[model samples]
Structure formats: C-alpha cells, structure tokens
Target: MRRWILLAALWLSAVTPACAAPPAPPQRILFVGNSLTYYGNLPATFAALAQANGHAVEAEMILEGGATLSERLADGSVQTALAGRRPQVLVLQERGGDLLCLGGRQRCEQSQHALQGLAEAARAVQARVLVLGTYQANAQASAALVEKEAAAARQAGAEYVEISQTLADLSRHQPDLPWYAEDGMHPGPALTLLDAIKLHHALYGMPEARTLEIDAPRYGANSGLQAVLRRADAAAPNAGTPPHIHYEHAQVERLVRALDHAARATDPAPATPSSAH
Candidate 1:
C-alpha cells in the first residue's frame, strides 16, 4: 500500500507544472538637476530607452531652470522628493561651472556641501548615487571642469559618469550634428538623445543590439514624453530654442547605434572606491 501511494504521488508531481517566480519590480531612478538635466525630456527619454531594452525602470526628476544644487537643497524640494519616492538610484548634476569652482570659492563650497548632503540622504535610503558631469562646447576648456566634478563625486562617495569626452568625440566625427541648442550652452535634441543613451548604459550597462531598434512614433506618443517636450520648449533660453527634432523609426535606430558607439569608445570615469560599498 505504501509503494502504491508513493508511485501515485510521483506520477502526480511529474504531470503538474512548476510554479514560476513573480517578475521583479522596476528599478526606480531619480534625477536631480536643472534645465540641463531636463531639456529634451531626458528622464522620459531614459525610461523609454530602458523599456526598449526590456528593462523595467521608472525615471523621475526634480529640475528648475538655472538652479544649482545648493539652491535645490535649500528649497527642500529634493528632500521631499527623496522621502516620498525612495528611489533606488539618485543622479546629481550641478549647474555648469559650479563644480569647477568657476563661481568663486563660496559658491563652489556651497555646491560641494549640498552634494554631500544629498549623497548622505540617498545613502540613508540605501540608494546608489551617481554624479553626472556635463559638457561644454569647448572640450579643452571643459577638461578641467570634468576633473573637478569627478573629484567632487569621489569626495561625496558617489560614482561619476562624464559625458564630455563622448560628446567631444562625437563632435569630431559628426560635425554637422546639432549638439547644442541656439543658446550654445544647453543640449539640443541630438545631444539629449545621446545623454539618454549614455545614462541608460551607465545605469544598466550596454544594451543589446535589438533594443536599439526603438519605435520612434510609439515612443513619441508616450504622455510622459510629451510632457517633457512641452517643459523643454517652454524653458528655452533667450532665442535658443531646441529644434524639437523627432526621429523616425529608422532614424532612431541609426542614431542610437551611433550614440552607443560613441559611448563605448569613451570609457566611463573611474568609480570612487566607496561606490562599491
């Protein structure tokens, strides 16, 4: 009777299907910066890119035009966002030249202090912190700024991702490409696309080739994406408005490939020793 019972159980087990594990929750990333971080709707663009690559990701941002990290910190908006969202990753971007101490010692110190405070808050939530270094039109002039930003990132116990080198390389190869808006300081649509791709790579590593074939029309139709576009359009500095370029499916694929190549060519900045912790 025992042998018959065991045989019956084994038969039932063999015929029944095994239960599958539930899918993982999406990775939550928060971007904290100014117009440079928002132009061309970078957060939405990044989310779209991750979706294309089969990654479940949620990207959000807190941005104000010409606002530095210190100002944002003082305003308490960043803190409120951090508390409410509890994102897994926090990306910090300082206004142009502030990290380089170009705005005098007082301003530079304020920026650094703000960055450290923000980093601590992120760490408290067990979130990884990343410092995104911006680029200038003049690569030679921006080199010093990039180094300063990288050093600051390390001091704050965060990882640094510098896009200046990649942008410079692209400028050399694709001179006709519009990397800057009419203002010449802010990023245009092409540059914004590049930024999104690089951020995607930084957060999730190199994407597969198949993921580069994004459906541009469908991506543009996303409500979140449209909202960002409107924000960027309204925030254009002076007469320097972004062309608001829209890519076709084929164009998007090609542009993504080119941007990916550029990103791969320029290695990411060395991570801070504490970033691994």
Candidate 2:
C-alpha cells in the first residue's frame, strides 16, 4: 500500500504544471511636447503598441500647441506633473525649429538650457530621459538639426533618438506614405507610428517592435485611435482627408505592415556624442 501511494504521488508531481509568475508592474512613461507629439496622440498610440507587444506600459503627456520646452518649464506644468508620480521614462521634444537655431543663437541656447533643466528634473526621480529630434522639410537641414539635438542630448546626459533621420530614410523608399500632416510640418500617422516604434526600441532594446503587426480592427475601435483619426480629418476636411482616415480595416493593417517592413529594412543614423560647445 505504501509503495502504491508513493508511486501515485510521483506521477501527480510529474504531471502537475508549475505556477506562473506574476506579471511585472507597468512601466510609466511621460511625454512633454507640443502639437507634433499630440496631433496623432502619440502617447496613446505608444501605449497601444506596447499593449499589442505584451509590454505593460502607462503613457501620459503634457502638451500645448506650438509650445516650446522653455515655455513648458516656465509654466511649471512639467514640474507639477513630476511631483507625485515619477514616471520610468521622460521624453522631451522642443519646438519644431528651436533646436535647429532657426530662431537664432539666443533662442537655441534657451531651448538647450531648458532641455538640460528638464533632464535634471527627470533624473531627480530616477527616470530615463529621451530627447526626440525633429525633422525638417529639407533633408540637409534635418540632418543638421539632428546633429545639434544629439549634441544637446549628450550634454544633458540623455539618450537621443534621431527620428528626423529615420523618417528621411524611410521616405526615400516609401514615398507614397504620408509622413507629414496637411500643414506639411507636423507628423502624420505613418511617422507617428514609426516614432513610437523607435522610442519603444530605445527603451526596451527590442527589434521586435519594428515587426509587430498592428491589429487594425482592434485599434480602429480604440477611442484614442478614433480621436486622432478624427483630428486628422478635421485638420484637412477640404483636402479630401488623408488616405489613412478612410482606409478599410484590411488596408490599415497592410499600411502598418508596410511601415513596419520599411522600418526594419532601413538603418537609422546612429546616435553619436558631440561637443557641448
């Protein structure tokens, strides 16, 4: 009887599955930017992508149309937002041309100083700082801007993602894709999706983000996604709306796949350290 009981216990132990570990807490990320960051609801899109990829993430943003980093700092909204809940990551984006010195040296210096200050604040909460470089219409100008922004990010001891270079490279191969909004300045849907993927890779060090297929039907039902699409349509009602706004579920999925393929195929410019001066 004892031998039979022992044999039964061993069989049960061999067949029983081990308990699964609990999931990790969601990573909190905050974005501080203007229209470029909010036009397509980037933070929300990022959260959606993270969800699709099985990464637990909480994304939040503080934005105002045409607002610059200096303006954000002066308004104290960022500091207020950072007071209680310190996110795991903080993303900073200056005005479109501020980092390019397009507004002159003094303006650019102000922008840099504001970025450094913001970086310091993020560090106080033990958060990683990511500076997003903006794109310009001219490829040469965009490259120059990326270099300048990279230098500033290095000075601030933050990681820089040269989204300008990424967009330029992707555009060369996928010219039909809408990279810019109706204004030809702000980011369109494709660029926004690519930006989110780049940021995800920077944070998580996963190339899989570039290849994940977005579920168009599920994403289309998402309120955040719908709102952004509506905003895009509203911005250019007379222009017959961007193709993305009218894309069927299947077409949306195809577009996302194509963008992902393009991103995977292109090699973004590596971030290099630059002289702070």
Give the winner by TM-score. Answer: 1
lDDT of 1 by residue, 1-277 (tens): 9999999999999999989899888787888887687666666666666777778777777766677889777877777777877888888888988887777999889998999999998898888898988886676767888888888999999888887877887778877877877777787767777777667667776544433332222112112321121222233333333334354455456566776666555545532222111
Candidate 2 lDDT over residue span 1-277, tens digit each: 9999999999998999879899988787888887777665667666666666677777767766677999877877777667666788888988898988998999999999999989998888888899987888687898898899999999999999878876887778778877777777778777777677677667653323323343222112112321111211123322332223222344345445654555556646543322110
Query: Residue 180's C-alpha lDDT in candidate 2?
Result: 76
- For all predictions, the C-alpha RMSD in Å is 6.1, 7.4
TM-score each candidate. 0.77, 0.74
Q: Pick out the ten consecutive residues of candidate 2 with the lowest summed lDDT.
A: 225-234
lDDT of prediction 2:
0.69
- Candidate 1 overall Cα lDDT vs. reference? 0.70
In model 2, what is the error at residue 242, expressed in angstroms? 13
Instruction: State the lDDT at 200 in candidate 1.
Output: 66
Mark the regions of model 1 whose C-alpha exceeds 4 Å error after superposition. Answer: 1-12, 209-277
